[model samples]
Target: MESRPSVARPFYSTFADLYDHVVTDPVGPWTEAVEGALASRGVERGTLLDAGCGTGRHAAAFAALGHRVTLLDASAELLAVASTRCPGAPAHLGDVRDPHLPGSFDVLTCRGVLNDLLGDADRDAAVRSSARLLRPGGMLALDVRDVGRSRERTDDTPRSTTVHRDTGSAVTFTHRSRWEDGLLVVAEEHRERSPDGSVDVQEFTFRMRPWTEQEVHERLGRAGFADVVTGPGVGGRWDRLFVTAVRRA
Candidate 1:
């Protein structure tokens, strides 16, 4: 397996405490899409692996539904919160790029993870590792923002906005776009204020490749997945694409 990248650590570590507040708003579409996929596929409950599990919000939900969940993430801080939320489930600290874990799971759920890891090689490695951990006839469900539809201008206007209700602070993020080796690189920075009147800033970048619907199908098929289905685009404004696949026996 290829060595893990450095960007994987800081992104989750620094944002762990603010993860649920930033990402899981009432209007957030990813949560709905994931739950919908599980229901549509009749995933009542079983062993599930939540790669890039973050603060374990989804893991807790899965566990609540009677699924034994293994939550894996690159950042220890994130796993700490995950552990507290789902005390009975095992929360492992590891990068998704090189997930060195044992046992196969009936379902693998990865959300808002792929876009953060740059480069096709890194992304593919993560996907392959997730696939390797799935049992035969299992399911893989993931969500990715459709960067192709995002506003790509260089202006300082907010392209992505997230509000923290607890602190009563709103963060407006801006993105700068660049084309690198047939991939669109969108760099973003979040500007937010703490409850104590302190300002915190975090920067992260993601490489979005030109992946059409056909490409997703081909790639999943190549990864030993059968019956790949591209679900409806979520996030209201076409910010995300949901995909589901089943492992072949």
Candidate 2:
């Protein structure tokens, strides 16, 4: 398995407690899209692996819908929140590249996890690993930003925004186009701000090999997936490309 440069740890270790406040609301649009994708593919209740699951929100949602859920994340702090929120579900701390996760799942969901890990080799390994975790005929659902859109933005300047609320604070960060080792690097920074004014920032960088919709289809096909579909984001353009692939039997 290929490994990528690791992202900084402060974001996961310290900022995990208040990770949700800074970003767009994921439960409504995000979850709805996930649920719709699964339903459109005829995915019914079954065992699920919430890889890179932050705080178990999606895992809890799956469980509530009658699917047995396993929540795994690289951050222990995030896993702790997941455990508290979904007591019956098992939560594990592990990297997405190699979950060391046991058993095949009926469905696998990974959101905001892929774009964080750097390096194309590592991302490819992670995708293959995710494919391996699925039982034949099972489904894998993940979200990624549309790098294509970024290239078309009018203002070439990177965008940075912050949100501070009574409950929690968050920072939204975007990096301008950068090239490394023949691969395009696009990253976003998210920091959690505490009531006392302490800040914890987590950066997620993606190394895409200039992928088009057709290229994505071909990659999924090579990964042994069938019936691949891409769709617009339920939240915003950030998650504009929602990919769903079913493991081939």
lDDT of each: 0.72, 0.73
Candidate 2: the clashing residue pairs are none
lDDT per residue for candidate 2 within 1-249, as digits (tens), equals 122333655446555665665344657666677777788888776898999888887788778878899999988998998999999888888988988988899899888677665565776778788889999989888776555653454243577756555575544444555655544665656655666677665566655543456755776787788999877655765524788899999
Residue 59, model 1: Cα distance from true site in angstroms: 1.5
- Alpha-carbon deviation at 146 in model 1, angstroms: 2.8
Residue-level lDDT for 104 in candidate 1: 92
lDDT of 2 at 179: 57
